[model samples]
Target chain A: MITTIIIYTLLAGCLIASWVMSREKTIKASKMALKVLVKTMPSLLAVLGLVGLTLGILSPQTISSLIGTEAGPLGTIIAAVLGAITLIPSLVAFPLAGSLLRAGASVMTISAFVTTLVMVGVVTAPMEIAYLGRRFTLLRNLLSFAAAFLIALLMGVIL
Target chain B: MKTIKRYLPIIIIGLAFIALAIWDPEKADASLTVSRDYLKEMILIIPPVFLLMGLLEVWIPKDKIRSWLGAGSGVKGALISVLLGTLPTGPLYIAFPMAASLLGKGAKVSNMILFLGAWAALKIPQLVVEMKFLGPEFTAVRFTLTLIVLVIIGQIMERAFTGRHEVLWEQPGESVGQKTKQMGTKR
Candidate 1:
């Protein structure tokens, strides 16, 4: 909600400022915006569909059931993979991780889930690649996937 | 057709929905609902973001952008990137275009990497939720560790992928809202 407001505010401010400075430039900017939007639309739609399917298939109940049964390095790996692939909002995901933890998920498992849930975005990769290029998108997500596991293991050691 | 190739993913997703519908109507319905909600959110946010990026490209001078976020902007630039990123902005998809624009405007790859990283993983609201559910200790540790890892990853990426060499920013005529040197020099 706040994010929506902030984005609108920023957009309005920038639009007004650009218009006041130069109407021609403002018009040109709007055209640029349109062009970029059109270019990105296909990938954006793909990402949205993928997100829907992944979240639908891996409902929270199913995830909890799947993640809670295991309790070792393999469990952590599963948790990381789940996190990497799924795009759960933090409001739901953090609490879900908490419950999973309380219900006997290892610290490493929950940590892997939380870290990868934020860092590695398999679902959003199409949109990311559209803007950031395939090489950059691939490298960032791949590195983030590795980083999530490392962070999870270190968290397991520390806490 | 070229257009068909471009829309391949969407087409594949459509087929998948059809398969899901046949295999499990309930799951298909749920998926459609989720996709609808997401499409609504995207519709609400994406246009304004693109417009804002457009305006930013037009109004913000390349020199000013370089001074603040360029390769030489150093630690201060990196700190600013994190600060800008951690704002209660929309999702990471929103950040991708903005980060790309910044890169085109001569922002350091390292800083943009941090910007995207922070946008994704370390927003304040997200951290609060993490602390609430994951415990203060767990949140703090992950936060600090993630920050350190982001810096390292940013540096590694900057070294491995020379920012200017990347083809992402090679669109002709306009470079982040400003005309290129050839046109400017000719003018």
Candidate 2:
């Protein structure tokens, strides 16, 4: 409810701002904005759909079972690697990670996954390349994946 | 041919999702329902985001951002990038395009990497959720540890990769938004 309210308020502000700004040259600005909106909508919709489905299908318990185990060193490594590969949006990943933490998933695994989920995106490669250049995007992701693994390993060792 | 090349991967991914849905209709339906719930939130969320992004694009000078965030930048700059990223609300999708735009304008690879890392690793909203669901200690520990890792990784990337050489920025006249504009103009 709060989030919704915040979003609505922001939307109202944006509408007002756009309206005021558009008054200077209403038709041209409106047309340009609409044009940009139409082009990006499909890709944006597709990404949102994928994120939604992934969240829907994977239960906290299931996610926990797969990578949340405290199977000593091996489990931590698996968790880290899996975390690197999987991409979860922030809105869902944190709550889910918190749930897994409650359900006995190691803090290390949850941390690693959350880190990698944001840092590395194996799935969004195409969209990323389209927006960010391919070489920069790919290298950054690869480095992030490695860093997630290292963090998990260190967390496993320390915590 | 260009269109096919551009959309091929998305098409493949979509087909894969369809296949998964067909393979288990029950699971697919459940997923779709959950996705719809999230989508509703996203729709509500996205419009303001679009406007904010537009405003930022207009207001923030790219050169100033680049000097601080550009390749081979200082530790202070990298830290600043990370801090800015950690404070932001919303998902990586919102960040991705913005980061890409910055990259086009001369944002450093290390800064972008740090931005992506910190954005996902340390979200204030997610932190609140973590504190509520888990505990303060756990959230604090995780945040600190992730911050440490992101910084260390940023340093490593700086060392290993020559950011100067990498094609970090977008080429002239090739923005995703620009492409869309051209398409619209044509129509």
Candidate 3:
């Protein structure tokens, strides 16, 4: 919330400064902003809705049990799915994952959780596609999904 | 038809929510709450970010981007990408537009991947929190692994997905179109 305020203030200051420097450029710039907003609106709403549904269905308790039930590849896959689908902030995610780790979850499971949580963003795909187009967004997510899985296995072994 | 197709994702999700409400109101309520909260954050943050990206397109020279992050940039470009990504910028989604603009301005696909990877998996503040909660060893291990894998992934993507791209916010009079912007291939 504070971040939002600071960003808005910074944005306002920058807009003002730009307007003072070049009214034409500022207008041109904001015109593009409007275009982008219009182009990306449906995707943005979809992201929000998907995030809500995923998080609602997979409560923290449910997530813990799914990731904690098994110590093998299955658990890691479950964790990865949970991470990819849900957009948990690092602040909340770290503590929850850490507690799960202490509560007998395998290092691989937690690694998969943390890695996919950051690397793969299924819920945010709509927004990604809006900006980056379908090909780049799909490739990035698929590749990151593979990388996250591999990294989890390595972390499980080494740590 | 195109309009409905564009809105299909949200429409499907909306139906899912309605079904959940009918079958189990409690779960539906929880989902709506989470969605509402996230919507608030998105609405608050997106405007400024988009405005900044617009300003960036106007202010930053295309050649500068080409030289700094293009194919010829090599190792230095990766370093710069990581540095740019690690800063406490906004969420991962915000980076998507910025990355696209940079790519349009001739950023290497590999470097952009590094940038996105660093932004997503390795933000500085997020690392601090990870170290505090998960201990230094765990943090150190994961960070190193993530960075290494990201570099590898970036290199692979650089090779695999090289082609023309659609530049959305081109100059004012120009409509959106595919730009055959092969970064540094001419050189």
Candidate 4:
């Protein structure tokens, strides 16, 4: 698939760049990369496990029906708002969105969910505040959330 | 105990999600499978993107980039930040960490807001996907409306908050250098 090819190509490019950027010996750079891999592994595994469990339980049809009905537009808005409030990881959000798409969910709904999944983060607030001051984090997320809702609404109206 | 108290809300939220997953184990399982596929896809796409980001971090001079992006007092900086964000090819997760780094360096609140807004509202890949699933007209309208909303929302944010915090422009290494220069002058 095109997506598969793109992913492989990006991975190859990343590896090459990592190789080229090493000022230290190749071995040291490789070791550092390995360290990063190790550090991220546990979290990655937990995410994988959660994702696997979620897929085993929820049917795409159910999610689609929920977001794609006469009441679907309202449902879509609420979902988008909720998605913004909840900080689901990108790894988890995409497949869920993809499944909803496959199950005949409206493009509007999926788009809204994906946008909010990334843009608004009620959960990451403290971390965001600590990193980028309180005013910046709060205002940016508020704006992002509003933008996401507008994007979804327009998509529904036009599409 | 102190650390737990600080993170209590996050902990509670996580528990609630887990509880939801448990309450309907079968539904959770299906969702998890889809989520796994998504994760794999993300893994495939993210590394190279991160590499390019790292390259940008190394190459782009923070202050130079910041001056143009700083305080959304004017339209030019806001528009530039939004455009810059629209062009990037990755998910929001990747953008956040990098944006945080930029904020540490001298990137203004408006620029950061623009980046986050545009990144979320207008991704090219997602647009193409939308076109395929919906149609061209729909995608165009959504894109236009989203852009307008982001700008308006950004302006509102700029007006509402005025407290200038020290963390807004805390670049690493520069302060140490400044301190050293001051000490030298004093001596």
Give the alpha carbon lDDT tens digit for every residue of A103-138 in model 3: 988888899899999999999999889888888888
- Point out the worst 10-residue segment of candidate 2 chain A by lDDT: A24-33
In the order shown, the chain A TM-scores of the predictions are 0.97, 0.65, 0.95, 0.53
> After aligning candidate 4 to the native by TM-score, how far in Å is the CA of B157 from where it should be?
2.3
CA lDDT of each prediction against the hidden true structure: 0.86, 0.63, 0.87, 0.58
Q: Which lDDT tens digits does candidate 3 get at residues B22-114?
A: 998998999999999988888889989889888888878888998899878988988999999998657898899889889878888899999
lDDT of 3 at A33: 89
Separately for all candidates shown, the number of backbone clashes (residues 3 or more apart, or on different chains) is: 0, 2, 0, 22
User: Candidate 3 — which pairs collide?
Assistant: none
| Model 2 ranges off by over 4 Å | A1-42, A68-70, A85-107, B67-76, B132-134, B156-187
For residues A87-155, write the lDDT of model 1, one tens digit per residue: 998889999999998898989999999888899999999998898788888999899999998999899
Encode model 4's per-residue lDDT on A1-159: one tens digit a residue: 464476467656755665687644334434433443443343344444444443343334444455655346776786676566544544445566666667677767777876676667664565455445577777777767767767877676666
Structural similarity to truth (TM-score) of each candidate: 0.94, 0.75, 0.95, 0.62
Q: What's model 1's TM-score?
A: 0.94
**TM-score winner among the candidates?**
3
In Å, residue A52's CA in model 2 sits off its true spot by 4.2
